[model samples]
Target: MRDLYQRLRITPEAEAAEIAAAIERCQHTALKADAATVLQAEWRRAEYDALHDTLSDIGRLRARLGLTHAPYWRAGPADDFSLPPGPPGSRFEEWMQRLNRAARAHNRWRRLRLGWWLATLWLATLAGGVALGHFVLP
Candidate 1:
C-alpha cells in the first residue's frame, strides 16, 4: 500500500483544504491523480486511513520481531513460506469480532475500576469530615 500522505508530502492529519492544495501543487501526474482519487472523498479517505494504519502497525511489528519477510510466521527458507491466494473468509471476520469484544470488555472493566476508586475516596472523605465535626464541636 502506498503512503498517500508521504506521496503528497503532507501529514496524516492534513485537512481537506491542505490535501487539495497539495494535489494542485503536485508535479507528478500519477501521484496527483492517485491522491485526488483517494483523499477527496470522506468515506474512501477514512477506509484508506484505517488500512494504512493497520499495515503500518504490522510493518512495525515485523521489524521489531526480526521477521521482516513474512507475517505471523517465522522467516525460514523461501520455499517454506506460502500465503493464501484469496481474500480472508469467515474466520478472519470472526477473529476481528472477538478482538472487538475483548477490547470493549477491557474498557468496561477499566471504567468500573475507576468508579470504584472514586467511590472509595468519596466515602473516606465523608467519614473524615464526620469524625472531625464530632471531635471539634465537642
Candidate 2:
C-alpha cells in the first residue's frame, strides 16, 4: 500500500481542488486507520507551512520593491500615480545594486575560496593523470 505521505504529496500548492481530490482518494482507499490519521495531520501541517512560506516570499518581494506602505485606493483619479524611487543603500537599493562595494568584497571572498578549491582539485587530477600516463606508456 502507498504511504499516507505519498498520497499527501499528490496535493500541490495546497489548492482546494487538489486537496479535495487527495482527501477523496484517501477516504476511498482501504488503508490502516492509524496511518491515514497520521497522514491527514501531516497534510494540514504541510499546507500551513506552504502558506507561511508563500506569505514570506510575498513580503520579501514587497520589501525589495520598496512597497513599505499599501497603495491608497482612489475611487477615481484624474492622473496616474506612480511611486517614486527609494533612498540610496536602502533595502530596495541594496537588492537592485548588483556588485556594490560591499557585495564586491563578499564576492571576492567567495571567488578566492572557490579558486583555492578548484586549484587544489586541478592539481590532484593533473598528478593522477601524469602518474597513470607514466605507468601506461612503458
Candidate 3:
C-alpha cells in the first residue's frame, strides 16, 4: 500500500474514492508494478484499520463518559444529565466531572485557536488591500 500511495501521491486522510481516483490517474500516467506499489497497498490497509480502531475507541469512550445521553451529547438542554452527588464527601465523581469539563475546555480552546488564525489571516489580507488602495488612489 505504501508503494501505491507514493505512486498515486496520496495520504491516509484521502477518501477511498480519492485513492481510487489517484490510482487511476497514476495508471494512466504509466506507473509500474513495483515494491513501491506493494508498500502503498500495505499503507492503505493499515490506514483503514487505524481509522476503524480509532473510531471504535472514540465510541467506547463516549459511552463510558455518559456522552451518549441526550443533554451532554446533544444541543438541547433536555438531554443533559445532572451530576450525581457522591457519597459523604468522597470526591471521586466530582473529580471525574472536573476531568470531563477540562477535556471540553481543551476542545473549545482548539476550536477557538483555529478560528483566530483564520480571522487574523482575513484581517491581514483586508488591511493589505486597504493599504494598496491608498497607494494606488494617491
Candidate 4:
C-alpha cells in the first residue's frame, strides 16, 4: 500500500519509536493520518506486514506497537568511527611535519642570535686590548 519509509520519513532500519515520532512530526506537513494507520490499526498493520515482510526487526516492532510506539530498543552498538593508519602526507603526518619544521626554524634562529652576540663581545674585547697596548705600552 503506502511506502512507510516515505510516509513516516524514516528508513526501514528505524526503530518503533523513531517511526512513530517521524509520523507524528510530519502529521501536519507530509504525513497523512491514513499512512500512520499501519502502526495503529491491526488490520492495517497486517496489510503493511504482508506487503513488506522484509522489514528489519525495528520495523516489525513498529508494526506491533502501532502509533503509540515509544522507543523500546536500546541504542545500537557504539562506533568509535576511528580510521586506520594512513601513509605519509596524511593528516597526522602533515601535522608532524609542520611541528618539525617549526622546531628546526626555532633552533636555527636561536643559534644565529647567540653567534651574533658572541661575535659582538669578541670585537669589543679586541678593540679594548688594542687601545690599552697603544696608549699604556708607549
Per-candidate TM equals 0.47, 0.28, 0.32, 0.38
Model 3: residues with Cα > 4 Å off, grouped in runs: 1-91
lDDT score of residue 84 within candidate 2: 37
Measured by C-alpha RMSD in angstroms, how accurate is candidate 3?
22.2
**Residue-wise lDDT of candidate 3 within 1-138, one digit each (tens)?**
123444467764677677666665665343534423433476746764575456556555554444454545454332222232334435545667899999999999999999999999999999999999999998
Off by over 4 Å in 4: 1-13, 17-81
Q: Is candidate 1 or candidate 4 better by TM-score?
A: 1
How do all the candidates rank in terms of lDDT, highest first?
A: 1, 4, 3, 2
- What is the alpha-carbon lDDT for the whole of candidate 4? 0.60
Candidate 4's TM-score:
0.38
lDDT of each: 0.75, 0.56, 0.58, 0.60
Candidate 4, residues 17-91, lDDT tens digits: the string is 886778777745433576566665667666676656644443544334332223452232111111224444556
In candidate 3, where is summed lDDT lowest over 10 consecutive residues? 76-85
**Weakest 10 consecutive residues of candidate 4 by summed lDDT:** 74-83
How many residue pairs collide in each prediction?
A: 0, 0, 15, 1
CA shift of 121, model 4, Å: 0.9
Estimate, for each residue in 19-121, the C-alpha lDDT of model 2 and write its tens digit: 5556665554554353345334767556645654565566466555676543553221211122333455667666557538778889899999999999999
Instruction: Report the alpha-carbon TM-score of model 1 versus the true structure.
Output: 0.47
Best by TM-score: 1
Sort order, TM-score high to low: 1, 4, 3, 2
